[model samples]
Target: MDIKEKIRNFIESNLIVFEDEAVFTDDDNIFQMGFVNSLFAMKLLGYIEQEFGITVANEDLDIANFSTLNSIVRLIGKHKQEV
Candidate 1:
């Protein structure tokens, strides 16, 4: 699957949404929506690094980069380009 699809799947798999039809857009703020927590961020960081084969710099640990699907994709794209 592509990067966006992979990220979406990973997010969905970890979400504990109460509504069966709950949906999130690429720009949605997952943290604000209560779909995930801070701990999830660490897991996401590890996943992004391992899955994309790029290291997340200490300076790149900003929550804004991982707060949404689109942002996460952009962050990975940035790191991949760096490699």
Candidate 2:
């Protein structure tokens, strides 16, 4: 599957609010959708680390980089390249 599909599946599996039916895109606001909060974002970071096999620096944990599926896909692409 593609990056968006991966992210969407991850969110559906991990986050309670992001069910299988939830709609998302690169421009969708994860914060605004209530899909992610400060607490949940941490969990998301961990999930990303485990699923993508990449390390996320503490300084890189910010909403701007992860506010949408598209942004997250881009970040994951970069991380995968580094790996």
Best by lDDT: 1
Q: List the residue pairs that clash in candidate 1.
A: none
**Which whole-number lDDT from 0 to 100 does residue 62 have in model 1?**
96
lDDT of 2: 0.77
Using Cα atoms with residue i matched to residue i, what is each candidate's TM-score against the true structure?
A: 0.94, 0.78
Residues 1-83, model 2: lDDT tens digits = 87688878777666656375566676988778876677778777887889889998777777877878888888888889877
The clash count of every prediction, one per candidate, is 0, 1
Best by TM-score: 1
State the weakest 10-residue window (summed lDDT) of model 1.
Answer: 13-22
